[model samples]
Target chain A: MSRWGRRPQLSFPDVGSIEGPLLEVVDLHTSFRTGRGLVRAVDGVSFNLARGHTLGVVGESGSGKTVLSRSIMGLVPGTNVERSGTVRLSGHDITAMSLDELREVWGMQIALVFQDPMTALNPVVRIGRQITESLRLRAGLDRKAAYETSVALLKSVGIPAPEQRLRNYPHELSGGMRQRVMIAIALACGPKLLLADEPTTGLDVTVQAQILDLLAAQQRERHMGMILVTHDLGVVANRTDDIVVMYAGRVVEQAPTAELFARTRMPYTEALLRSIPRLAEASHTRLRAIPGRPPDLATELKGCRFAPRCPYAQDHCRKEEPPLRAAGQGHLFRCWYPVGSAEGDAALAYNVAARVPAALAFTGIPVRDAALVAPNAVGSA
Target chain B: MLRFIATRLVQLVVICFLISVFAFLLVHLLPGDPTLAILGPNDTPAARAVLLHQLGLNKGLVSQYGTWIMNIFHGNLGASFLTKQTVTNALGVAVPIDLELVVVSQVLALLVAIPMALIAALRPNRLFDRIATTSTFAMLSLPTFVAGPLLVLVFAVTLKWVPATGFDRLSQGLGQNLKSVILPSVALAIGSVTVYYRLLRADLIATLQEDFVTMARSKGLSTRYILMRHVMRPSSFSLLAGAGISIGTLFTGAFVVEVLFQLPGIGYQLVQAIYSRDYLVVQGMALVAAVAFVVVNFGVDFLLTILDPRVRRA
Candidate 1:
């Protein structure tokens, strides 16, 4: 009955009660039916995020972090994609919602800041029009009001001469500026949840930091739940409240950020943590790369996905897949011998003695340097 | 933008000049002589020589070309060898028909192609997409020559719905003019629609996969709205380029369709001029067609600059 005419109102059942988590995803599975085979992009991932809390989903490329974020947003590409499981926002089931129904949820309740801001914005559209479109459509703001809000949003995102920038196209902006515009568009409607899928992936380091700080600051000011998806652990190290480590389209580990780093359990997470190049380390240090490529999702696997690359891998690890099990308070890991356990230590020691070259190969480093770097790596773990 | 337009205008002029030279030389290179065609073979050598001298055929090729170029600048396209009528006067009568045919067909083709392409792209690999793809291929394979007769048989001969051949000027009743032009226009349009349908469909499929489209989808824009606004514009670049080149083919197609329908268009005149070896008419038509090609391409470049920010900024 408003300006758009006869749109179905998207009213939540209980708007007043805010007891449960703001977002809850349970047993999510998203697969693609490619010509080769069925590729399980996000194989059985589940996590919950509370209001105003930040959750970081970390993984290597092809580990399904992006897919997982998209799956939550119900934006999986292609009709061939097969998705199952519940995506609940504030106790309301959205997994079964039609696109028309989901339209109400998107932009108003949830929004996404995509990776590769270079290509994430429509090149032909003016920046102001792009930002104001959702405002007019979803928020039902008048043209003048939307324009004013768009200018304010751009200004809030730290763009200079917001009035003039509104007229410029995406190609006219720098990469970092484009990313800021993307953030501004995502934040325009003031959604309760913001999914940032590697928001700073292609920005320069200084710009990356600035963009991340801007996002964190905005999230805090708006008190919005955020899911920060990034392959770089350092981006989420101090920013997120909780972290989910994905491997081969599955959640290998999930823990509170401080707890995960202080007492790392999964060997894959430990390897990922070790792989980060620290500035405090002496210059000219060869980075310890995680050996072996991520497993092909099209092919079925019987054991833990990380077993092939784990130095602490045992015969039992090769025989059976490990279920996500609770290791400690607010921490879960998918490993038979969790790190720092007696069995894990004995396994590492035995592997080091029996197959020193194999142990060195696991870290993708020289044998002599492996021993020299092991102490410094384990001390951090 | 002004500088870009100026550069393009300069380039267009250069292209048209080269095309004029080529058309002039190619027409003159024909096996039979225009003078011989005009005068019977039994004509005396003295008479033929006098005619040749008068027509300036005895002059050097360069001198003849220089005179033709100078005449062109003075707005004289020369007189047809057979009819002895000014080529510009004939063109004045014929060019409008060809323009109407081309413009109507292109408009019809776009009206059909854009929607079909969009529907196919939106539900790719589905029944609609499969049907559209197969039909476009079928239409593409069905040459204008064949499609023209088939349409004539169905609409004019079999159904007796409209006239099968001939054209009415727009000075005539608007409705009758449209009715007369519709069959030939449709005949020419079928081939163009097939090309545009395929090009737009392919580009839309690829553009719909772009991250910005995903971003738009994530923004809760309706599928229809996204396809129309965000997906259509960016996906149109390749289609626009293809359409610009297709204008040349449209002319060729128009020649065949015009002859089939006996429409009094430039294409019909062109075919008649070629068969009778009317050198001046052929040269005039060729120059006009070449100019149309260059102008169409120039327009496309300007449109691309406006549509694409990357090109605009560059």
Candidate 2:
């Protein structure tokens, strides 16, 4: 505990080895059969989330990050969806649950907070009613009890004047307030798992930070395992316990948060890190973006999904599919030529060293604490 | 909301007064003298003139219009030129029959159309949706006269289930009257249903794309719940709006159905009045129909405002 300010005591049980993962997505492949052809939105993706931990699924649009979240939530559209493999949430096979059975678990055991809070809410209904609709239906709460609980929910999500706010419509509330309301609704029944699909995607930067902070705090308080799907790598760095880097519908790399950044084995993961605008670096410097758009999911690719985009793709990468191999302890990467091989590691290390001076020359720090604080700053940047 | 009603009321009054003026002038300007119909051709010209003078038609057009307008203001549409019965008394028979016909047909249309639309939208591009679309298109294409006869042949002549022609008041016996009215109501409703189904289908498809539906599914709401709660409620306004806008067409269809079925409704009476060259009866009946169209449409507008808050706020 810190000596200065009081920290909210979180008496969460210590992270353990015996509990087994709360959620395990084993090689899930979900494809939609459209008129044009079969588009594999999520192809052979796999991940695991232990209890009370956060797994950040990070990728650009069309990388199947959002689709992964939806697949887990069992909310993919279209009747002709060809879904194979298992999404075991709390040890239940979600793919086999009937609609009624799914409803029984929806808000009570698992819930989703969608990207756009404004459009995600029903415009015609009152906020209070929308919050209570699931609670009352799933939890069998009476009208009085549901309504009273709804107020408490609004307050829990950090909305001021909960009673008055409940009377307001979705449009009447600000964007930030609407997002808070959405979180409140999702958490009303205290679900064990929360799937936030780009939760702060559309908000202003300031609001996005606040929302992320709130979500982090809430997840810790409730001891809820969260799967945060986002394109912003910076968001995952500070919040998530584990990171899954996906490229073109497949999980290319998975590792602990710090290791994924400090020792990115996959070229896609390396490119993604290089693409982020570091505050410790120079201003007005355009980011090092990954060349070429994501591979078309409709077409059958024989080799690595990222081969066309990967700068280090060998002739073998074009012919063979790279299986996810152990890169380090608790770290895996699906790359024929991993970023830290003898050939790439020397260049990568040299690049990291060269980047330090360039970064220092770029951001002239406001030097109050001297140069001793620079490494901590580098970890953040 | 009060202001909106007040404004609508003011407009209604102005519209009603204009209707009165038009009805009065059109009758006065009509080709045949109403007295000739009232008094048979055997009556002497002098006697006919005296009857006309008594009815105030012998006066100058301006004075005559003023007097007719005054009578209209005092709740008199003038006595029936031929029957000498108060037009109001004649209307008591005409209005209720027509009201029942219109109401019944609308109910039938709504009942049939909403379900057809939902089915079509739920399974779009499938055989059922294709069939419904084709059926509604066929119904829309057929004229009411043709439909009326075809229905009569099938249900009345072939099946021998209902009478082919003629109407009896429900006071005679609810069952008998309903049997008599059913064919005509069905005939009239087919057209309305065709239009309503098309509108509702379009609305349902659009409503399905709304974010609330995605939200509903994400919350694990069943397809049925999502359809009813999210898709149906939001789209119900479009159906009502369509119904409101097409009231004039429905009334016209009602007229054709009434005449075809030999129902003694306002449309039938108006036809008889027009054929007999009974100017007062024709003018009064036409004016009443116009008033009904206006009132029904206004009420529909008000209902739309209530159902869709956006319209009220606008």
Best by lDDT: 1
Q: What is the TM-score of each candidate against the true structure?
A: 0.95, 0.85
lDDT, candidate 2, A144-250, per-residue tens = 99999999889888899999998876878899999999999889888889999999997999999989998999999999999999998999999999999988898
- What TM-score does chain B alone reach in each candidate, compared with the true chain B? 0.96, 0.91
What lDDT does model 1 reach?
0.87
Q: Per-residue lDDT tens digits of candidate 1, residues B1-314? A: 88888888898888998999999998878898777788978888999999999989899999999999899999999998878889999888787888888889889999999999999988898999999889988988998899999999999999998899888888889998998889988888888898899999999999998999989888887776787779889999988998899876566447788889987677788888998888888899888887887888889999999999789646
Show model 1 residue runs off by greater than 4 Å. Answer: A1-6, A13-17, A356-358, A362-381
lDDT of 2 at A174: 90
Clash pairs (backbone) in predicted model 2: none
Against the native complex, each candidate's DockQ, computed on alpha carbons, is 0.67, 0.28
In model 2, how many backbone clashes occur?
A: 0
